[model samples]
Target: MRLGAIADDVTGACDLAGRVAEAGLPTTVLLPAPPAPGHPSPTTEHHEDVFAGGDDASACAVVALKVRTAPVGQAVDEATAAAQLLLDAGASLLYQKYCSTFDSTPAGNIGPIADALVALAGADGTVGTPATPGARRTQYEGILFADGVPLAESPMRDHPLTPMRDSSVVRLLAAQTAAPVSLVPWEAVQRGAAEVASAIGAGHTLVDALTEGDLDVIAAAILSAPRPVVAAGGAGVGTALARAAVAASGQRVDISRSQLPEVPVTGRLLLAGSASAATRAQTAAFAGERHTLDPLALATDDRALDRLRDALAARADHREPVLIGSAPEVARAQAELGAERAAALIEGALAELAAFAVHELGYSHLLVAGGETSGAVTARLGVQRLLVGQQVAPGVPWAVARSGEREIALLLKSGNFGGPGLFTDAWEVAP
Candidate 1:
């Protein structure tokens, strides 16, 4: 693998992988076990088999890690281990993927992990940007925005996991690391890559970007370097790099877009585990049977799992689509079950629901929302490998996975992805 990426969440990992694949590079998205502490080498006996399948040195390989919201110490160690595994796998280029909204608290895995990776690679410095305009997310003048509204004033302000109360990307990044931070405005980005890289070579930077063009310029500068650059950003940056490689090679690059198999879309189950305002809007507008998971019930009810079964059964009987989600009130959930336990409970419930639906009930397709939720459900279902297929919708693909003797198709969606009607439209047109 020439290019290796470490994403902080499962859904984000898939998105990052897809962006590179779309740029005509064969790709593999793997969930690897970080090497154990005191055992730095992946060849150690203590570590689980990591990156077992995809080892094509010419391809783009991504290792998905779930430390986006982990404690600082644990996140740093895990990220360092993951970096070593990719480096061992022959990846000369390393990119750390985070959310397009630049979601993270002042004390974070973002800044600290970037510092760790930069030091590990012995690179000049790291670059950070969360500007993915295709996802309707961008950063300008050090501030993050969704559509036209500032992130702090947007739906992300109420994010259940990492409530982004701050919009200044530079300030947000600076608070998390002692590294010297600088901001390159959009004008400098438009001035082209060399200037932008000159600014980044001095120290870590928050590059201003409002459109895909900005990313293209940034990618050109980053890739033009005499040696490999240690970079971290959203999926857009990865996409830019892949496309730049295609252009520089001066040959037709083979982009492996997933193709939908001739399978029917029956026995499909949709799990909405995100509490973002965008997710709430999409779930509410979904024209189907909806079962909102009660946080109070999941945290305290003795028969909560049974209740979930009953709700799913009723929906299954009607052959109507289903949406099971905890309400978007993160504060209520935090107060009721605590953030850590609350997320674990919700994800655990969704995982069980999905396993029963797919393994016991013989369901064939599953549409899941939320990065953490997707990670949990995929783990519970024993999905060790995935074959990325053509998207059912934008950023939502029909991916094939195996769970024992069963082959299941899953569509994993991040909380802030897709339009309000994305769910209904996906079901109406999928395999």
Candidate 2:
């Protein structure tokens, strides 16, 4: 692999992988192996089985870990192992990919995980930004904004897992790590790569980027840094990183090679498990066979599982896609059961249903919404890696995976990504 990215979640990994492929590098997204018997989850294992159809020597990779909200130490250890696997596989550049919202608590998985990757890569420090303009997320003067509003004043502030109460990346990162946090202002970024590179130091630098040009400048600066370079960002910088990597190596990626890999198209299902505003809108906008799982009922009642299973079974002969999701009232569920407990319960139930749909119902085309939901579903389906395919939305792509002889086409969408028609319109471009 020429460039490796360690993302905190499945959606982020697919998001970065899509950008990398857009830059003309054939990309793959690898999920960490499921734990062995009696072992903890997210145990790292070298996946030689990935990139099934692509040339390993020419392809890039993104390792998606279920650590966005995991405990700090666990996230660090898992991410470190993933980085080692990528680096040992011959990746010269490492990109730490997270959400454009910069989702994290004060005791971060982002800061600590980045610190670990930086140490493992033996880099001076990493520069990061969550500026994905197409997604309406951008940074200026080290402060994150969503659709022109400061992050703290935006919908992300009400996030269930990691409420972003502050918009300043410098302050948020400084609160999580003992090391000093620095900034590369737009002034330096506009001056070009050399000036931005000079601003980097032995501590994490939060670079400002409001446009694609700024991202190119920031990515060029990262490439020009010392060997074994490590950087961080969302999909915006990830695209730039891929471009810079190809340019630095004097490579000519065949853009015409962009096409979705062949996979089975039967038994299409849309599983929505996120309560984000975008996801809620998508669920509401979808005009199809929809089944809503009440979080409270699913957590407390066993028949909820049977009902959902029967619902899927009833659709066996139907060709229209079915949309299944939990109730949108996450706060009520969290109040009834603790936050983590409620999330675990819902995710576990959803994961079980996904496996049943794929294995028992013969589902091959799956659209999963939400980071945590996608992680659980993919793990339950025992998917180790995915081949990145044509994007159905900005930062959202069709990922193809194989389970034995069955090829599954998965479109894993972040809860906060995609339009209202995402759940319905995505099928028009299925692989």
Candidate 3:
């Protein structure tokens, strides 16, 4: 079947599948979780048992498994068993999950897995991560015993997992591989659909292997005619990718009999500090409204209250979106705003909903601009699992989880992450 498997953290798996699909291979992604909410208890029980079985049919049939818990030795043991089972089932290809904390170096993780896979397959095998260059060197030294190949992806260039992606293990794999290791450039796909088309036009075969978020971008790419589309990754990205592929290819996108997720987004955001001028400008530009969140007014002076109120009022008047900037600063500001003031803002926004409009007010989307503020707002709200972006950096590290009735989207940024036009790149197409 010329099949491939991707095993990594949840986000890495989804990102990798998106790249692999661009590279042109039929793929499947298997996550540890079941998709349906309140699904049959037996389904969850069966999945866990499948791993405990450590057999080939179970392993070969399985494409990807996300290990959320740490001390990864146990996860590795389970993976080894599954690999053995898959080999017994006549499977030749396999991939393992790699994390920075466990291996300390990419090769530390990749080498042993490759050696094991080679021993089992009696042939070469692939191991990879979206880690980084220095770590890749360390991985190369560790992989002395086996023929290792590294698969690299671009979307994760600045990702927290960079340590794993750029490790020596990946570089060595890329150098040794017969063909150029698949390069899934984040910039190419960030434009959503057109990049997929461009990749196929550039001679790559498209595989529909996304399993998170919406498939709107992927669907647009498939419609452009990338051949042999295969769906895999997080259940959300996978299902959406499969549906899109089916609609495009006029055939069903075969799915593994694994449980998947129903909703596309999960996680939360934490904002801290006052909004930066650049952030307000960017938000205003993106939302097609005038800048309202005044950082100067909110931070340097004691008028944060008035500034926040004014910002909210402006949003109400123009129906423009409001994005809180910073997390740490917001936390500090919270002391001044007090529980009563903070709750009033949130409660006021919520009140604007149809039923509460007379007595309450609310926002369509609460975008906390800064990571620190995000944390403060979430804590004040007494909610956990809110979407959070990594400490303000290059690409916003978005973590989405369910929060009551709200689907929070946090866009984290720092003064140094970029200047006024940083996010403009997100909207640009790769030339």
Best prediction by lDDT: 2
Our model 2 lands, by Cα RMSD against the true structure, at 2.0
Clashing pairs in 1: 1-57, 24-255, 258-389, 258-390
- Which whole-number lDDT from 0 to 100 does residue 74 have in model 3? 41
Task: Give me the displacement of residue 133 in model 2, in angstroms.
Answer: 1.4
- Candidate 3 local accuracy as lDDT? 0.34
Tens-place lDDT digits, model 2, residues 150-182: 999999998888988999988988888877789
Looking at model 2, report the run of 10 residues with the lowest lDDT sum: 49-58
RMSD each, Å: 3.3, 2.0, 14.9
Please give the lDDT score for candidate 1: 0.76
Order the candidates by TM-score, highest first — what do you get?
Answer: 2, 1, 3
What is candidate 1's TM-score against the reference? 0.89
Q: How accurate is candidate 2 locally (lDDT)?
A: 0.83
lDDT (Cα, tens digit) per residue for candidate 3, span 129-154: 22321112112222211112332332
Task: Show the colliding residue pairs in model 2.
Answer: none
Q: Rank the candidates by lDDT, best first.
A: 2, 1, 3
